[model samples]
Target: PRLLKAIEQRMEQAQLRYEISGQPARVFSEFLYSTLKTWSRPRRVIAKAEHIGKANPRFVVTSLPQFDVDWKDDVTVLDAKHLYEKVYCARGEMENRIKEQQLDLFADRTSTHWLKSNQLRLWLASMGYVLLNEVRRIGLKGTKLAGAYCGTIREKLLKIGARISISASRSRYRPRIRGRSCSVWSGSGSEFLKHRPISLTPLI
Candidate 1:
């Protein structure tokens, strides 16, 4: 019902734009709307009425206050266009992240015989995704793997063959590179971090 109202509004705006500009133009706006039967109170509803060859009306309901409080943080207060473009789009990007974890990182690999083993596998896969996300956020700032997916990073960076020699005092590794120098893999914001095992603490 709300969507239908937004489409109607968009149709009127499109007609007005066609009358004024002599061509179909895009119209965007936000409205404070509420359905009496569904919503308890009125909320900020964003509406985007766009027409290129056809009508494309989109709507999003947000609990964010428009002018209720002081605009201290820029993240809290946003215009109708920015809200739809950034905030709503970011929500869709989060779904992409979830898909990356499940598909790329093998989070859905749960064919084990035991339930506990499958649960552990899922937990380990999720933790691997978290750690890889942290690596991209904290470590891979300006490297080639900065925007690489978990599977891509694994295949390109982590799956390289290396020769390791262990002595009484120390261990040495000669990393293999396919027709490339070792310096390209070792330094220049491409050095792998040493992982130190730590005791797990319960989240409060």
Candidate 2:
């Protein structure tokens, strides 16, 4: 309840959209409502989320919510690497646990149960990704872009401009350059840019 309340307060200030799952607040609170119940150790609520991602035909999962809220129009989908680590990889572990021990808390014999389980997993993965990114953004402080949105983290932020051009079945992106193509001296060097664009865009 405290965590949910805190998240709600912060969301108001940050204008964030969120929703809660796992179990209802009332259900959780019921266990702690009485002094005797409080004295007893609470049973662990073991809900697991597995990311079906591209393997499934549904939307991508990224984060968990504390309250049901509408999503803002401006939110961008997180990067693929972050999605893999935060969703697919984590879900893989849960799948292993279920198959190995048949100890999944949410698994059911019905197809709807399986579908819900998969969807929940994706949502939780997305939530974890968002939370982790927020921490990174806060820790980095005054550096380039404060948030990690699925691409290389810029060391020294650069200023550039861009224009989008499109044609039938084809689209071209043109970016105005303010500097020369220079070697990046930070971590991974060329390896980071191997899969990502080399052009650095500052979040000023």
Q: Which candidate leads in lDDT?
A: 1
lDDT of 1 by residue, 149-203 (tens): 8887677667888999999999999767763234434542443455445789999
- Give the Å shift of residue 113 in candidate 2: 9.0
Q: Show model 1 residue runs off by greater than 4 Å.
A: 1-28, 31-79, 164-172, 178-184, 188-204
Q: Tell me the spans in candidate 2 whose CA falls farther than 4 Å from its real position.
A: 1-113, 145-147, 151-204
Error of 2 at 59 (Å): 29
TM-scores for all candidates: the values are 0.54, 0.19
What is the model-wide C-alpha lDDT for candidate 1?
A: 0.74
